[model samples]
Target: MLTELHIRHFAIVKSLDIEFRNGMTAITGETGAGKSIALDALSLCLGSRADASLVRPGCDKAEITACFAVAKDSPAARWLAEQDLDAEDECVLRRIINKDGRSKAWINGSPVPLAQQKSLAPLLVNIHGQHEHQLLTRDEHQLHLLDQFARHNHLLEATKAHYRQWADTEKQYRQQQQAKADREAQRQLLEYQVGELDEFALAEGEFEQLEADHKRLSNHRSLDEASLFALNALYEGEHNNANGLVQSAGQRLQESVDMDPQLGSINELLKQAMVHIEEAALELRHYQDQMHIDSAELETIEQRMTQALKLAKKHQCSAAELYPLHQQLKSELQTLIATDEASEQLAEQRQTLRQAYREQAKKLFDSRQRAANQLSDKITSAMQQLNMPHGRFEISVDHDNQAPATAKGTDQVQFLVSANPGQPLQPISKVASGGELSRISLAIQVMSATQQTVPTMMFDEVDVGVSGPTAAVVGSMLRELGGQCQIICVTHLPQVAAKAHQQLQVAKHTDGKETQTDVRALNNDERVVELARLLGGDKVTDLTKANAKELLAS
Candidate 1:
């Protein structure tokens, strides 16, 4: 339950500190007395959005803090543990909004994201404002309420899991089917690519070697003629040869050796030179005899090289990459063919999952039917006690065939009310008056007592459109609910105010220059005065005071 609330520079509230306690507490004041302001501040602390306009005129920022004390084994204790925040027995939630639309939130005095703060709220407090009753018309909330009443969360979770699997399988199946039309076209393209590349059959390093061989073959005659001429001039000449000339020189030098001793060294050098010339003449004869040219082989090499270059250009790759490209294309085409087969297999699995989801959804439908029957009875009884004697409540669970399998279920639930006898039961949103709706909402709340998750509930003017005996019953319902958990109600009805275990009266005053709102816990005498004021407007007559005293005594 909420322990304390503090508001600073929030709206017209400069600074306010209020301590709350167990049981039902009534907050009452005249029009424009800031009764809604207190609820607004509490809502902010409970993770509602904050705006710059909420700040006081002269203040730079607005702050609201709510403190809660929970049991050791409560959901909040586990939440704090999960978040790694400091937790003892109490949790403090604080929110601050600056004048520039910037805001901050804290959990247990540790800085936290706004989403974390919002996540923590449902476990601590449940606030039902005037507009919240409109949720009765929504399919999701109606199904949610049915599930809560049924206490079948485990089964609901199973249904959701099965539905998700079915949904995902269906999605993949659709995508693959959409691609099937293009699959054949793509496969043919890849096959053609593979065939084109295969014609090259070029080996690594073969392109360079072939180019070199072709060049040599093309210049074969020129190379042979040049070598033969050079050899004839040096050694194969018919008139004179290099070997004979060198031998003649050596003989002449030997003859001159008799005249000079230095001529003997020159004769030996000429003899060695004649031996090298004779070796060169033998090699030139072998070279001239071995030369042979083939034009056919050269033409074949040129054709092969041209084909390799053309294939490389068409594939946007080098001549050496054609073989690898062929292998890659073959692998991709094979996979595409396999995908068509795999897609059929997945379609069969999707059907299986859909069947599973249908079985799970049927179970949910049966559970909701049973729960809705029991809830309708309980709420109808509650409405009778709330002064709607002729009112009838009904829950319609209609099957929705066209709804998605992954949605809440195959059922569309709606709440209907007939406020008077002979009036056909119509949708709650269309037929129930504001006062009747308030009572119906109260009835539903009372019926789902065990399903309430939080230990604290605040009803902001739940008695707004109710008065007379209905207002008294509304107060009784709130007091009865207080026995199980804390209840805070802001109201303008004396019947409701007089039933509270504690009453806080909000009043505003101006000191000629500044206006301020204050909330003070009313004593027994003060309660009478406040109740009398509520009953008689600004004039608390003796009869109204007596009536107020009688209500307090009861």
Candidate 2:
């Protein structure tokens, strides 16, 4: 329920603040008195598209704020929480339009994008324009409105779920078919690459080990000569060589062992060192004797190393990475083969899902038919009170089992009407004039709104062509609806305005220098005067005042 609305520099409204109530509130004024300005201001905060032109002629910007008292578990509250903008049980939506046409929206004092404001609007308020009856002629909207009124959420949700399953399966099937040729091409590429890598049979660290072997073979003669020189110098040197020096040290230590007991330990250490030096000298000599190079083996090693480097460059990888790359390619090949195996199973799954979609759609079609009948009767009965004495309203559903399923279901729904006797029922859009449509729209909205979860409903100029007893009937209908939710009605009929629990009178005040629009909540006597002006003219007679009082009493 909307608790308060504030408008500043919006259209002709310089500054206006009004508190709203839970039941019906009527807004009325003479022509050019800014009667619709309040509704327009509320709409801005409700996410209607904004323009800078809406700003009061001399003002720099226009701003509107609407505060709603929301239920904890309502959709509006849930949306606010989802957006992280909840403020206890109150939700405030604000919009600002600058002179340069820039607009900003906010929820709970936090800035939000325009799209978010638009999304939350419907959940908070449903505004029906004078021409919204034309929307009833569209199939989907008709179907949707009927569904809302019928409260067939279970069937609708089940159908939607089944439709999603079918759609996903179909999408998958089409993608697989489209990719068949491409997958085949990829398969051939994978096979060729995998075969090449398998034949080469690369291993981890193989590149480094092979390079070491190649270097050793390529310089075999130089290594052999160097080892021999070192062996001869260390083992066969006549003086100052390693083996000779070690022997001399050991003998000296042995000579001193008798004088000092510590010298005996040093003497044994010298003996062990000399033995180790001798063993090293012999090993070097053996190495020199065994050293030899095979040119053919060296050539083979060079060729193998060159081939590995070339393959690495060809695959855009390091020599050591070749093995891992080969493994990855093989894994992908196996997955492709598995996809081939799964294709047959996916076809079967698609068929099963398609059948499920059809069955659910059938159920939805049957439910819609039943809902349409009930909805038509309700609205048709409502139409009679709104001045359409012979008006007949209907919801027509044409179910096509063969029609390709849409997300909504397989039935085409439309509203039909016959405003006069023997007129022959026609599509509502063709049969109803602007006035007739307004009343019919009122009836439909009243019927639909009773079943809606939204807490606020606003009707702009809904009583356009209605007057006399018919206007009272429309007023009564709105009043009845107000029992269930808050209603804000912009009307011209005094009878309609008189029936409201609250009356707001819109008036334009002008001086030679400035002009402004003001809206004030009318008290009991003030309401009677406003109604008298509506019933009479610029000058209200005593009779009109009495009639106004009588209207209010009714």
Candidate 3:
């Protein structure tokens, strides 16, 4: 339920704060007293369009804040939790509209997009505008009303999901059918590329090793000559070679070792140098033995390298990248093959989805048919209480089995009405007068309200064309609705105002320079005066006061 509304510099409201309770509230004032200003401000908090004109003259901005006490398991609470904006059982919606026409919204102190506010508004409050009866003429609106009255949210959601699945599968099937020739061409190209790469069979790291081997083979003669010369200089020379020179030096140092201790250290260094020289000589001899040039191996290595380069150039890659490219082409070929398989299965998939969608749509149609009957009966009964005793209301639920599937199913809902006895039922839009439309709209709203989960319902002059004892009856119906949830009505009828558990009077105040509208809760005595004003005119006579009291008493 809406607990409070705060408005500042909104239109002519200037600044006003109004507290609400868990019952019917009647808001009334003189014609130009701005009784609807509060409702307008509340609408802004509910994510209605905003404009610079909504700001009071000379004010920088307009602000509206609405506070509600939500039930733990209510739709509003669940939505807030889903958005991470829940503040226990309390929800606050705030909107600020600057004079430049830009606006911002917030929920639970966290800034939110205006769309979120719009999405959450219906779960918290249902506002029936003064002109709501105009919407009843549309077929879509009639269908929506019936579905809302049906209260089959899960069924509706399931039908929508099924429809989406069917539509998506059908689109995929059509696209695949159109692209069959193209896919087949692509598959052939991929297969050829993959086959060539597989035949090459390049291994990881093998390219670098092959290049090294090719270089060695190509320079075989130069390498063999260099190794032979090094071997002769180091060991094979026999005279003054490194090995003989170091051995003679060590023998001379050994002969002087007894004469001086320093000679012993020198002799040991000479011995180590001779050992290293011998090891070097042996390694050089072994390298010379291993050096040989084979023309046949060289030709074979050159041929393989040329083939690798040629293939790399053809594929627009280096030899090193040939392996990776081959793997990539194989993957693409596999994907195309899988797509072919999936396309072959699409017909069966689409058939299954189509059947599923039809099943859900049928279920939705059945539920709506049952709900239409119940709603028609209840609204017809309500019309009698609203002073239309001979009126008959019926909801026509026509299911078209041949129609293409839709998210809302294939049922065409139409409201039919007869205003007098022995008259045939006709489309309500074409038959009902303006006053009858107002009463019928009210009846429908009342019946729909009973099925809604929203805790607050506001009616802005929904009783516009109603008067006489019928107005009193309208008031009584609203009061009865208040027993289930909060009801706030912006009205001009004294009977409606008198029926409310609480009343608020909107008054306009003006100085020479400025004008502002103020809304205040009325005391019992104050309510009587306001009702008297509504009953009579600006001049409240004693008889009007008496009549107001009588209305209150009743």
Candidate 4:
């Protein structure tokens, strides 16, 4: 239940703090006196959209805080625990709206996204606005109300889940059917391309080796000439050959070694140089013997390289990538082959899901039928109390087996009513007058409230088109509802205001420079005065006061 509300700089409310108790509370004020200011503030804390105009004229920001007493096992408590924002059995929701229309929300002093507050709002408070009855004309709203009345959340969720799964599988099946021919064509093309690549069978690193051999063979003549010239110059040449010259220099250095020890080291270096030259000459002679000019081998390598380049270009890759591309195509072909088998499997799965969806939807349809009958009886009874003694109310739950499945199932729910005696039942939207609609809307709301698990319900002038004894009945109904949960109503009717266990009077005060709206809890005497004012308008007569007292005594 809501415990307290603290609002500052919101609308004409400069600052207000109000404590709430565990029964019906009526908020009353003159026209334009901002009777709904507290409701508006609470809405902001409950994650309603914010506007800069809601801030007081000269204030930088508007702030609203709402505190609730949460049962340990209530939905709000569980949600708070899940969000790691639990504060024992108390939950505080705060909202701050700046003049620029930017807003921030907090739960238990921890900042949170506005969406988080929105998600938690329904679990804490259920607000019925003045214009909520206008939505009753909509078919979707009617269906939603029926479902809420039914309270078969688990069955509805299961139906929705099955519908989604079936719909998804159906979509896949249709897409696969449409793409079957294209898939077959692709498979044939892949088979041909993969076959060609397999026949070529290029090994890894073979291209580079082939290129090296091709270069070597193409330059074999020049290589042979160079090696023969080097061999003769180093070892085979008899006149002034490198080996003969180095040997003569080493012998001269050895003869002078006895005269100078440094000359001995120079002679050893000359001997090492001569040995290196002789070994190099022998290597050159071996290379010259191994070198050959083979035109046929060169042509064969060239042809192979040409084919590799052609294949690489066709596949949009380099010659070295042909082997990898071939393996990738093979994998794709295998997957496409497996997809054919998967299509059959998916067909079977779709049939199974379709059957499952039908079963769940049927269960939901049956539940709606049962709930519709009970709700119709209750609303009809409530209508008689609201001054429509001859009114007949009924709920039509029609299930179409041939209709395509939807997340909400195949049930069409409509509210039918006959507001006058001898009138045939018709759709409420087409038959009920504005006043009748308001009362019917109120009856539905009352019924919905009883089924709600939330601890607090706020009605914002839902008694708009009701007056006389009907207004008193509405008030009494709200008071009775308060016995089960907290009820806060913003109303103008004195009958309604007098029925509340507590009354709050809203008054607008203005100076030359500023206007402010104030809300104060009304004591018994003050409540009498307020009720008298409501009864007699701006002038509170002695007769009106007496009547106010009489209304209160009832």
Each model's lDDT: 0.84, 0.87, 0.90, 0.92
Residue pairs with backbone atoms closer than 3 Å in model 4 (clashes): none
TM-score of each: 0.80, 0.76, 0.76, 0.79
TM-score attained by model 2: 0.76
TM-score, model 1 to reference: 0.80
Model 4 agreement with the true structure over 46-150: per-residue lDDT tens digits: 899999999888889999999999999998999999999999999999999999999999999999999999999999899999998889888999998888888
User: How do the residues 1-554 of candidate 3 rate in per-residue lDDT, one tens digit apiece?
Assistant: 99999999998888999999989999999999998888889889999999999999999999999999999999898899999999998999999999999999999999999999999999988999999989999999999999999999999999999999999999999999899999999999989888887787778777788899888878878888887777676667868877677778888878888888788888888888877777887887887778777888878777777877888999999988887888898999999999989987998999999989888889999999999999999999999999999989999998877788888898889999988899999998986489998999999998888888789999999999999999999999999999999999999999999999999999999997999999899998898899999988898989999999999998
Check candidate 1 and list the clashing pairs.
none
Best-fitting candidate, scored by lDDT: 4
Q: What's model 3's lDDT at 469?
A: 97
Model 3 residue pairs with clashes: none
Model 3 residue 172 CA deviation in Å: 2.2
For model 2, the stretches where C-alpha displacement exceeds 4 angstroms are 81-86, 152-169, 188-328, 341-367, 400-402, 432-434
lDDT value, candidate 2, whole model:
0.87
Model 4 is weakest, by summed lDDT over 10 consecutive residues, at 445-454
Worst 10 residues of 2 by lDDT: 230-239
Tens-place lDDT digits, model 2, residues 1-554? 99999999987778899889989999999898978887788888878888879988878899899999999999898998888998989998889999988999999999999889889998989888877766877767787798888777888889889989889888998899899899999999999989998898877778788889888888887898788777766777766887788788888878887888798888788778878878888899787677778788888878877888888899999887887898999999999988877876789999999888888888888888888888889899999878788999888899887898888788888888999988988888796477888788889988888888789999988777777898999899899999999999998899889889999998899897788888889999999899999999889889999999999999
- Residue 423, candidate 1: how far off, in angstroms? 3.1
Candidate order (TM-score):
1, 4, 3, 2
